[model samples]
Target: MRLYWTMPDELRIHYKNVLQKYNEEFTKGNLSVAWRHLERAHILGQPWPREHNYVHWLMLKFGIHIKDKKEIIGQIPRLLIGGIKVSLRRTAS
Candidate 1:
């Protein structure tokens, strides 16, 4: 969900660590690992505002050839408002 203020320091650090891991995986051409890390980050529920920003940064960082970053980001609103659900879709077909 979309947090609108600063995240807790611990959660922020956790997210950054996840981002770093994701970037490392990307550099190694390990898309699967990157996806797994991103998914984990998403489930961590750190905070809304920072989490939204992180997701955007992640999309830019990892979704170069994928055209659904905006759609994926949009889901953040749903997540924030509705909580996690089984129907969440990160990529647009």
Candidate 2:
């Protein structure tokens, strides 16, 4: 988090745009393009919390409903501090 903030504001802004692009691609249901944005977001030093959105994408792509707690847990990395917090309305039912 500190490292990401240490970056020049201009560069940070560029990464923010990358994050937006990720959102844009995600909304379009283009997983490949969206995944690239996640990589770009990471390279720009965005923190792990940002990766949370990708997990949702994965859950949807794989047809893993949030109610299947264990399955959702297995899909994403556990290294990130916070665990899953699924919004039922947004996730697969």
Candidate 3:
């Protein structure tokens, strides 16, 4: 929200853990597990614009890697506007 630099330490730790897990699972070809980690990261990052956008970007790349037309298409908008929406919502609140 407001592009603040202060992310709670716990959240930052959890977010990094999820991303690391996602990478590990992806490396092992555990696509489903990787997706789950990505999803969790997405939830964890919702309040931070850069993190949210980054997760969406990773999701988009994942979709492309898996050749999922729907996910790839779906993530485009989220990748483009998800962060802006979070900032706007926070400002409104």
Q: Each prediction's Cα lDDT score?
A: 0.61, 0.53, 0.91
Predicted candidate 1 versus true structure: per-residue lDDT over 1-93, tens digit per residue? 432345578887887798789879878979889878887777654345347545655655455545567756655565454323321222111
Kindly report which residue stretches of model 1 are placed more than 4 angstroms away from their true locations once superposed: 1-4, 66-93
Give lDDT tens digits, candidate 2, residues 1-93.
122214467776887798788778878888678877766765554233334455444544433522566745654553243323323222333
**Candidate that scores best on lDDT:** 3
What's the TM-score of every candidate structure? Answer: 0.56, 0.47, 0.92
Q: After superposition, how far is residue 20 of candidate 3 from its true place, in Å?
A: 0.2
The per-residue C-alpha lDDT of model 3 at residue 61 equals: 97
TM-score, prediction 3:
0.92
The parts of candidate 2 lying over 4 Å away from their true place are: 1-5, 46-93
Pairs of residues at least 3 apart in sequence or in different chains that clash in candidate 1:
1-80, 2-48, 3-48, 3-49
lDDT by residue for model 3 over 1-93, one digit each (tens)? 344535688899999999999999999999999999999999999888888899999999999999999999999999788888988876766
TM-score of 1: 0.56
